[model samples]
Target chain A: MSDEIVELTASQAAAAVHAGELDPGELFETYRARAAADTLNAYLWVSDRTPAGPPAGEPAATSSPLGGVPLAVKDLFCTEGVPSQAGSRILEGYRPPYSATVVRRLAQAGAPLLGKTNQDEFAMGSSNENSGFGPVRNPWDETRVPGGSSGGSAAAVAAGLAPWAIGTDTGGSVRQPAALCGIVGLKPTYGACSRFGMIAFASSLDQAGPLTRDVTDAALLLRHMVGRDPRDSTSLEFPEPIELPTREDLRGIRLGVPDELVGEGGGVQDGVRRSFEQTLELARGLGATVEPCRLPHAPHALSAYYLIAPAEASANLARFDGVRYGLRVDSGADLVSMYSRTRAAGFGPEVKRRIMLGTYALSSGYYDAYYGTALRVRTKIAEDFRTAFQSFDFVVTPTSPWTAFELGAKLEDPLAMYLNDFCTVPMPLAGIPAISIPSGLSEGLPVGFQLAGPAFSENRLLAAAYALERAIGFDSSPARRRDPGGSTP
Target chain B: MLERAQVDHVARLARLELSDAEAERMAVELSKVLDHIEKIRELDLEGVPPTSHVVDVVNALRADEPTSSLPREVALRSAPEPVAGGFGVPSPGAGGE
Candidate 1:
């Protein structure tokens, strides 16, 4: 019974609850127990509250669209009384007095908080290894990463610890991990979801997205997550209501395969390339026209993103002075030393590296050469997308050049780690929407097929992905192939 | 490439203190990142305007109205040292440079 319960997706579980076939309390307990028993170090904190079964006489579905389904949130979302650490020691044990807008809305819509998942410190690294807490292991093979800074959230969904989870994508944080973990991930158009209580990383780029076992679940979760909030000035009301895609054929869709991302010299592994080519063939068979397109400036997106994101981070992170909330290391002398000591003690190597890099880039003489040039490069990248959208309804690429590598493989080289975002960074730079769905397996690992569309085109993107997902039919069950002894990291 | 002294200077500007070992390593690592970023300077962006924000939103100020705010105690709950209904800090001149 427990095994069967764990196998149901959030949609199926919600339906069962509406029909009185599954008790909400029992459903929450099953996921909570699995989360507490997680060997991947996915969950930083698990909630103990057994949800009060939907008010006395109301049907579960009528009370909330989620039907009391439980959710796993990345630690970056402030959850009122729950510890929202953002996977950093600086904010350790610092529970916010209020919940993030997204978290609050999801809870109001009947999804109970299941746990807070681990991530890279301040959402800075490409792998979960940078987390102040221990790294989150890949459930598919315990030896490799699950991709990050959304590693824990992706691992939780792929391993069935949570029905679904929310993760933030500054660059490829959501999609890269989803690809590696064999699940669906989506980065909504910029400002689609309010950023109210989410701990700031790179303000201009960070957007909260969902990591789910399937495309439909991704759509369902996103419907309730987006809205304008009074607190977040950048947030805008979604142009249209999100709908679960019912489209099964791509009869009129035009998919642009960008040479900059998929062509030779892009460092894409042979196995990944082969899988991507096969998926393109599948798209053609479904009556979709696939043409080679060029996003010329996309090749330089990583260079621009690394500078821009960190520059914003350097300013946003300045709020962590010793005088305010979070950890403080006092020098017992003066205020300046106190601030310096607290930050040095609290931040990890990656965070400090970025802060220093950003400060240098923005400093007097180098600003024009580094920071200013990066922003101009950003303009060209966005222009490339604009030109492509004139001809193609959607642009496609392999989410990452390679599948998940060993745990410590890229840890020593930050450049190699930054390269992981090569394919996914351009969309965020353009402020467009992109979704990564499992295309197939290569070398016994999952490869993601990414579909990106112009700004506010999520409905169209989701529909196209749903059709392709059915045609590709990649199995995600291998994520549960955990060894009995693998439970102890 | 950034020098060790340069890294230390940047760290001070960012309000972070790095150990000698960290500074040495940072000088090399930050240089590698900056080298990759150097490619952008080669592009002719003479007419291209910098995009600080992707979406065009200007002066997005909310209406001036007072609403309930976080109580002082609740706001200070996460502070490392709460003093006199506020966050406590070291005296400004207790220890001089």
Candidate 2:
């Protein structure tokens, strides 16, 4: 019975619960036990209590859209009374007084809290190694990283510790991890999801998304995760409700393969490139038109993103000055010394490096040369995408340059780590939506094929991805590949 | 390339106190990053305007009506050092270099 329960996808579990075939409490316990024993370090904190039914006057769990499926949340989303640390020592043990608007909405829709997952500190770094709590291991290969800063969330879903999880993407944090872990991850258009109560990383680029086993689940989870909130002025109403995609063939669809991202200069690995080409061929077979398109400025996206994101981060993180919350180091000196000491002690090395880089970029003399230029480059990148969309319905690329590398492979080289976002950064800069779907394995590890569209085009992207997914027939179960006995539970 | 002194100056501007070793390491790492970012200077951005925000939202103010706020005790729950009724901090004129 436990084995059968673990095999069900989130959509299946929700359906079973709604039809009175599965008890919501029983469903919660099964996942809770697995999360408590998680050896991947995927979860930072697991809830002990089974969620109560919706509050009085609300619909029962069986009638709700989510139907009581449990969710694993990345630690950045502030859950009232639950430790929401954003995987940094600076905010360790600090629980927000109120939950994020997204968390409250999911609860109202009948999804219960499964646990808080680990991540890279303040959602920085490509691999999970930057997490202050320690890195999460890839379930496929324990020696390899799951990719990050949403590594824990992706790992949780892939390892079946949780049916689905939420992660924030600021330069491919969500999609890259999901691609490495063999699952679906979506980054909605900018302003599609509210940013309130989500610990800010890069204000303009941060957007929360879902990591799940399939495209259908990703679409379902995102349906309830979007909307406008007065607290987040940047958030706007989604033009329409998301519907489950049923398209199984991509007839009349046009895909644009960005030359700058996929060409030889991008450092794409042999296996990943092969898989991407094969997926394009498969799309062509499914009646879609595949053509090469150019985003000329995309080659420089990584440099622009690094400058812009860190510049915003330097300003946003200034609030952690030991006066209001979290960790504090009293230097037994003046307020200035105290502030400096607290921050230096609290933030990890990567966070400190970014803060220094940002400060230098925004400094009096250097501002025009660095931050100002990066912003202008950003406009050109957006223009590139806008021009490409005029000729194609979706932009296609390999989600990552390669499959998951060993945990410590790139830690010594920050440049190498930043390169992991090379193919995934342009869409976010353009404020467009993109989704990463598992195309197939590259050397026995998953390689994701990414499809991105113009702003507010999630419905069409998901439909196209759904069609490609059925045609590819990629197997998503990690347990089957790891152990024949299926003894994880 | 960023010198150690420049790294220290930026650290001070950011209100972070780094040891000599971390500062030295940062100088090298930050220099490499800046070298890569310098590629943007080759582009002709004469007429390009800087994008501060991707979405065009003007004056996103909400209603002036009052709503219940976090209670004093709940708000202070995570403070490292809570004073009689607020957060505690070192005095402005206390000891320092």
Candidate 3:
């Protein structure tokens, strides 16, 4: 049981711990040692070691689901008393006085908080190359990127650093990296999870979800994570206790393949394309009908997303002025100089670039031309998805353009980096639920299949993903991002 | 296309400084990207209303109760250098030249 216990999903681990066959403390110690191993650079910081000796006794239901499973949160999510840097110098060593609602929920569910994983400063970049800490390499290839800003979380889970990690998607931050790292990631309907503790990037678009080894694991962690929080007003009121079933229940479902999406941008990698098509065939064999569909405005989605995200980021990130919390720099003896020095010295290159682009778009002269126009474009994209979903149960696309590229390959060019989220941004703009499941691999890297549904359709989406997950049987073995023993190349 | 001078002005508005070489490079890159985005202007939005949110709702809130503030020392501790009254900083509206 101990041997099987190490590889079990978070749900399985909790059940075993409840039955007394496994001790929570021992499990915590094992994961800590794995996180502590130092090869992955997965952790920005880990809390003081808590062994499997005795519970911290926080009084959470010990027999409840996800009890005692260890999980890592992306640095962007604030954890009380933990230095929440968002992988940027601007927030250097800054500790939030409160845990994000998501982080708080995990702790309440008895999943011991593992350390925070590295991320792009303010969750701005696709490659994690923009992070102040350093890029988190894919466990599969040291030279390649892990796909980002949730890159650290994906790499950690792929390398078996932990069974599950929480990541935010404001674009493809969660799913793209999960796809690249060969993991299961789900970004629920925009309001499905509360954002009270998440540091805002683009308030309207940002979402928090899980990255796990498999769909069952994703389901277990998400069941505990998604909820209404008094602190986050955007949180949705859904029926409580969302439960997912084993693979056998997914027959006769409907999946829409938008012809407009799949063939554009040259679609996915060939190997991934083969793998995804095979998975589609597998679904048909299992009784799900697959049909070509249309989403006309989706073609313009990437353009509008780039504009809208920056415009919102310009306003949302204005809180980091020298007057408030986080990094502060001194200079020039005047109030304006004070702001310039603090922001210039604190924010990373990518962060500043976005802020400037956003500021320009929202600025007086350009506001009506740029930001205002982008919002109109965003509306059409949303309406397109709404109309398409009426006829199709769900829409599917290859999660990203290709498998993970080499680290620093796309870093120098900002446009190339922004294009990484090209496929995943439309759903967020539409305020719907989306999930990425490991469909297959190209060469050695993994590819992801995306499925999106109407708002609050998470249960049905989860059902479809679960059925598809077992059918695909994607395997990403020995994905070690950092082997302190120097075993990986 | 945004001119080289426009890129410089935008950078200043955003409080960033770029070397001449970096600025020139950025001019080329930003122009190309924005040109790609020029496609948005082609949309016939005629009377469409702009969307400000996706998951729309009023602000989530707690009672307007006062919360504890970080003590003066711990809160100001990360200041790169501090002054008598507050954390130090550069002039406003732009990074100091």
User: Candidate 2 — which pairs collide?
Assistant: none
Q: After superposition, how far is residue A76 of candidate 1 from its true place, in Å?
A: 0.8
Q: Rank the candidates by lDDT, best first.
A: 2, 1, 3
Model 2, which residues run further than 4 Å from truth?
A480-489, B94-97
Please name the candidate that would achieve the greatest DockQ relative to the true structure: 1
Candidate order by decreasing DockQ = 1, 2, 3
DockQ of each: 0.77, 0.75, 0.44
Instruction: For residue A39, give model 2's deviation from the true position in Å.
Output: 0.3
Candidate 2 per-residue lDDT, tens place, A1-489, comes to 766887898989999999999988899888898888788888999999887777556688789899888999999999988999999999999889998888888888878889999999999988989998999988878789999999999999998889899999999999999999999999999999999999999998999999999999999899999999988999999999988889988898999998899998799999999999999999999999999999999999999999999999999999999889888898577899889998999999999989988889899999999999999999999999999999999999999998999989999888889999999999899899999999999888899999999999999999999999999999877542343223332
Question: What local lDDT score does residue A102 receive in model 3, on the 0 to 100 scale?
Answer: 85
Q: List candidate 3 segments past 4 Å from native.
A: A1-5, A51-57, A247-249, A480-484, B56-97
Native-vs-model 1 lDDT? 0.90
